[model samples]
Target: MPWPSPPVVATGFPGAVAPVRVGRQGIYDRRRTLVAYELLFRNHGGASADLAEGAEQDHATSQVISATFGDFGVGQIAGDKPLFINLTRGFFTGELPIPFPPHQVVLELLENVEVDEEVMAGLRRLKDQGYRIAVDDFIGEPGRLPALGLADYVKIDVAAAGDAFDEVLALAREHSRDALVVVERIEDDALFARCLAAGADLFQGYGLQRPVTLEAVSLTPSQLVCLQLVRALTGTDVPIREIEDLVASDPALSLRVLKTVVSAATGTKNEITSLRQAIVMLGPQQLCSWVVLMLLGGVTGVDTESLTMVLARAAACARLAPAVADLAYTVGLLSGVASVLGMPEADLVDTTGVAGTVREALVQRHGPAGAALRAVLAYEEDEPCAITGTGHAVYEVSRAYLAALSDAMLTVGAVAGDS
Candidate 1:
C-alpha cells in the first residue's frame, strides 16, 4: 500500500516529524521469525504511560503516531512487517482519527476499552474497512469476551495470568478460534517452552536473546566541539548567525551541517552552499538533534561497536519514552560517557551541569528518566526482570531496542561514509 502523506504543522515541517518517541517489540510466529511489532509509548521515568483516558492519553497516542509515521518511517522501523498499535477508547470508537491504512497496521484494542454495543459496532465498521483487530492483555475477563469474537489476534500476558495462564490461553483459543493466540512476556527458556507446549501460535519475550554490556572510553577535541554546540543550541537562545559561527568554527561540523541540510532538501532546485544558510535552513531545533546524533557517532576514541551501541540505545530511549525526549536522549547518550571517558558515572554526572533528575538518572538511575534509562539498559543487557520495577513492559523495552538498532546502524553508516 502507498504510504499516507505526513501531516504538516505550523513549522512547515511534517507535524508527524515532531519530537515524539515510540517503542516496539517483535512478535514471532511458531517458526521464530518476526511477523509483526507492537509499538508502545514510554512516559517519564521509563514506565509505559497509562494510555486509557484524558488529554495525556491523547497526546501520548498522537506522539506515537507521529514518531512511527514521521521521524522514524515505518519502513525503516518495521519494513514490510505489519505494526500492532494499541488504541484507546477514542481511537477504538472512531472518535479519534486512525491515520494508518488498514493493510499496514493491526489496531490493538486495550483491555480497558469497554467492548459494549457501540464499540462492537465500531469494531465491525473498522473490520469492514480492512483493519485487523487484536485484543490486548487478554486474561479472559468476562466483560472483554465480546471482543474476542471479532479479534484477529488475542494476546495473553503469561506473567499476569500466572496460575490461570493455561485456562486463559484455552479460553482465547476457544472463543477466538480463528485468532492467533500470542503468548507474551516469555522471559526465560522455561516460560517459552511452556508457552510453545501450550500451543501458542506466536511468541515474544527476552528468552530469545540477552542484552549486551557497553564499556567506557575517551573523546577527541572535535567531538567535544560538537557537544559544546549541542549545549549551546539547547541552552540559552542563540542567534542563527552566532550558531552559524559555531558551526563554521569546526570544519568537520560545518561539513556535516551542510551535508545534512543538502540531504534533507534533496530534489530542491537550489543547492545549499554555506554553513549559515545550512543552519538557517535546517533550523536550530533540528540542528541540535542532528548534532546530538553526530556526537554519538563522532566520538573519537570510542570503538565503532561501542559507539554504535550507545547511539542505538540513546535513540531507542528517546523513541520509547518521548515524554522526556531531551532527557531520555541525554541519558541514553551519556550513559556511556563515564565509561567512554574512563571516569565514574557520578563524576560525569557532576560535571555535565545536567538537571537533578538527569543527574539522578545518570548517577543513581532514579526517577522516570532514570527508570527509562534502566529499562533501556536492561533490555540491552537482556535482563527482563530488571525492567519490572522500572514501570516499563518487557515488550516496550524490546521494541525500543529493535527500533534503535535500525536507527543507530543508519547513523553510523552515514557518519562513517562522511568521515
Candidate 2:
C-alpha cells in the first residue's frame, strides 16, 4: 500500500530560509471575552519588543502577516476571531500589497503614519473593498483627526495617553460613532474597571494577557515558485493536471498536498495514490489556499530524521491497514506536524480543516485508523503489549515496520538528493 514517490524536480527559484516568529496579544470585550488579537513583531521567543524595534518596520509587519496566515495559520492562531494587524505607511498608502482577505483582518494604521489626503484616499479604497480600519495608539492629536472619520476601531494607549485617556476616549466615541474604542495598556484591575466603566469596547495590555511568541521554520522552495503555483491555481478554468504538475515539482509540497487532501476526505472509499487525484478532490480554491500559505509560511523545517520517521509511520499505517490506507496514512503523516512545530495536536487538526473520522483518529485515536496508528506508535516504542489491543499481531507489525523503514529512507534520500 506504499504510495509511489513523485520525481523531485528543482524549481530553480531562489528562496530564503530562516526561522520566523510573531507576537500575539489578546484583545477582550467589556465582559472580558476574547475577541481579537493584535499581532506584534518579535525578534525572539521573549516577551520583550526591544529586538523588534531595531528591525525595519515594514519588514516586521510583513513577517507578522506571513507568519500569522502562512506559517502558524489564522485558524490555529485566532480561530474564528479577526486579527488586528498594524500597517505601516507602505501598506496604508497602498505602496505595498496586503495579501490577506479583508474579512480576516482589521487593518491598523499605526500612530506614526502621516494621514494625508493621499493616505485617506487609500483608506477609502480599502474601506470600499470591505476592510475594517483601526487607528492605533490614538491620543486625540489634531494631525490624526482626519483618519477618525473612516475608523472602525480607535485604539488608545492608556499609559501613553495618561490624563488625556478619558478625553481621547470621548473624542473617539464622538468622531467615529460606529468605531469600537479599544483601550490598550490596562496594567491593573483598577484600570480595567475604569476602562470598562468608560465604555471601552475592547481591552489589551500586559496585565490582561502578555504577548506569546510563535516561531516556525521556513520551507526550502523559492517563494517565486510557490507564488507562481498559487497564481495558476487561482486563475479561471485551470486544468487539474496543470496544478498537479506544478505541485509534483517539489517533494515537500507534494507530501503536504497529499496528506491534507487524504486527511480531509475521511469518508472517501477510493485510495488517493496520485497528485492529480488529490488536486481534483481538493478543488482549485482550497489547493490555491494551501499554496498561498506555503508561499507565505514556506515549508516546515522538519529535520531529515523527523521527516523520515513521519513517512515511515505513514507507510507502516498503510501497510497495516489496507482497507483504510488513505486515512491511516494521513493520520500517521500529520501525527508528527505538531511535534515539529511545537503546537498542540488539536490546534493543528483544526488549522488544517481535518474533520469527522479523520479528526477523531488524529485527536482521540478512535476507530480502526486510530488503532492502526496506535499499533504503529506502540511498535515504534517496542511495547508489544500495547500493540495487542490494537488487533494487529506483533509479527505482522514488525514486518510492516521494517519495510516501511526501508521505503521511508529511500523517499527521504530522494527528497534530499542523496538517492
Candidate 3:
C-alpha cells in the first residue's frame, strides 16, 4: 500500500490506493455483555511490512484511525460500545487532535509507551477531549505510576502473572480505584474462579466459551429441536406449521417472537398477540432470521462472546459473497455450534438437516461457500490469508468481517432488551 502523509480527517482523502483492514476481539463485563472491542489494525499493502519493522508505526496508526473514523465510520464497527485501540508512543504524542468521537474509542497505551512529561501532557489533552485511556498488559512498573494514575482500565495477563500477580493488582488498586481490572488468558475454570475471587472487574479469553470438553458429548433433546427448527426455516419448502410448533415448544422463544412482532410491526394497527399471527406477518425471510438468532442464543454452555463471534462471522461471510449469502451464514454459525454444544461438526450436519452444499462447506471446506468460510476464519485469526476463487481481495474480506461486528451487537442488543 502507498503511504501518504496523514490526512486531517479520516474521510474523503485523496491518496494512493491501498486496502485498509481491521479486526476486533470483544471485551465483556461480568455479566458477559459486550462493553468494548480491542481493534486490531493491518495495512494490506507493502507499507505495513515497514510498520512491522518499527519504521512506519505513525503511518500505519494514522491509516487505522482514518479507516475506522473516516472510511468506515465508528458506528459501522462499534455501535454503542467503546473501541479499545492500541496506541504507540508516536500516536500518543504526535497524532493529536483526533477527528473521531472520543466517547466511541478507548486508547490502550502499550506497556512500552513512555510515561514522561510530554506523554503525560498528551494524555491530559486526550482526557480533555473526553477519550478514555487503558494501560495494556500492565506489569506494575514503578516509573509508570503517572500513566497508571490516568488509566480508566488496566489489563493483566492471567497466564503469565506468576509471583507478581498480587503485586500488580495491589499497585493498580493503590494507583486508581476507578480503573477496571481486566484479566485476560483465563484458560480454565480454576483460573476464572481465581480471578473472580481476586476481584477482576472484567474477563476475556476463549476459555470462558470452551471451558471443558465433554468426553461423551452429544446434543440434548432441546438443542436438537433448536437445530431442527433452523433446518425447517431454511428449507426450500418452508415448514410453516413445524416452524411455528417448534418455536411454541419453548416458552421463552414464544415470548421473544411476540415481542419481535410487536416491536417490528410498521404499518399494522393492531398489536400481534400470538406466535401464529407473528409468524405470518414476519414472512418466511424475517422469520428465518429471528429463528437463527434465537437458536444461536439458546445454544447452551457457550459464553455470550463466542456466540456473538459466530453470528458476526456469518454476517461478514454473507456480505463477502451475496450470491450464496444464506448458505455462507449457516456454514459460519454451524462451524461453532458443534463446539458450543460439545458435539462434532459432522454430527451437526447429519442431525440438523443442513443442505448438502452447506454440509460440504462445514465438513470439508470445499466449493464456493467453503471458500468464503475459509476467508472469514482466516481473518478472525488476525493473520495473513488468501482465499482463492473468491474474486475479492483478502483485505476486502477483512473489512467485511470488521463491519459485521456492529450488526451482531445490534441484534444481540435487541434480544437482550426484549429479554
Question: What lDDT score is found at residue 194 in candidate 3?
Answer: 80
lDDT tens digits, residues 31-113, model 2? 88898998888875555454233126766676676666545667667877888998788777766666656766899998888
RMSD versus native structure for model 1: 21.1
Off by over 4 Å in 1: 1-18, 44-52, 209-419
- Greater lDDT among 2 and 3 belongs to 2
Q: Rank the candidates by lDDT, best first.
A: 2, 1, 3
**Regarding TM-score, does 1 or 3 come out ahead?**
1
Consecutive 10-residue window with the lowest summed lDDT within model 3: 5-14
TM-score of predicted model 1? 0.47
Q: In candidate 3, which residue pairs get closer than 3 Å at backbone N, Cα or C atoms, i.e. clash?
A: 1-45, 1-46
Q: Which residue runs of candidate 2 sit more than 4 Å off their true CA positions?
A: 1-22, 28-35, 50-59, 62-82, 89-104, 116-122, 141-143, 163-167, 189-200, 212-238, 241-329, 335-353, 359-419
User: TM-score for all predictions?
Assistant: 0.47, 0.62, 0.44
User: Looking at candidate 3, what is the lDDT of residue 33?
Assistant: 72
lDDT of 1 by residue, 1-419 (tens): 32222111111111111123467778888777888888777543444565557556656765565445533456555777988887777777866666545767898888778889889999999999889999999997999998999999999999899999999998998899999998878898788878989999988776763322111112321555566677788877777766764554343344345444533432355533233555676777767655654443323422345455656666677776677765666666666444444557676554333346666766788766678888877776667788877899887777677777776666556444544
lDDT of each: 0.65, 0.71, 0.60
Compute the lDDT for candidate 3: 0.60
Give the per-residue lDDT of model 3 (tens digit) for 1-419.
Answer: 53222111111111212234665567777766768777666535422233452335544554455445433445556766778877778657843324344646789887777789989998888888788998888777877888888889999876677678888888888898899999888677687778788888888776654221112222211344456666786788766777765554332244334444544434676533234665676676665554443333233322235445655766777787677765666566666445444557787555433356666877898766677777776666544434434455766776777677677656545443443
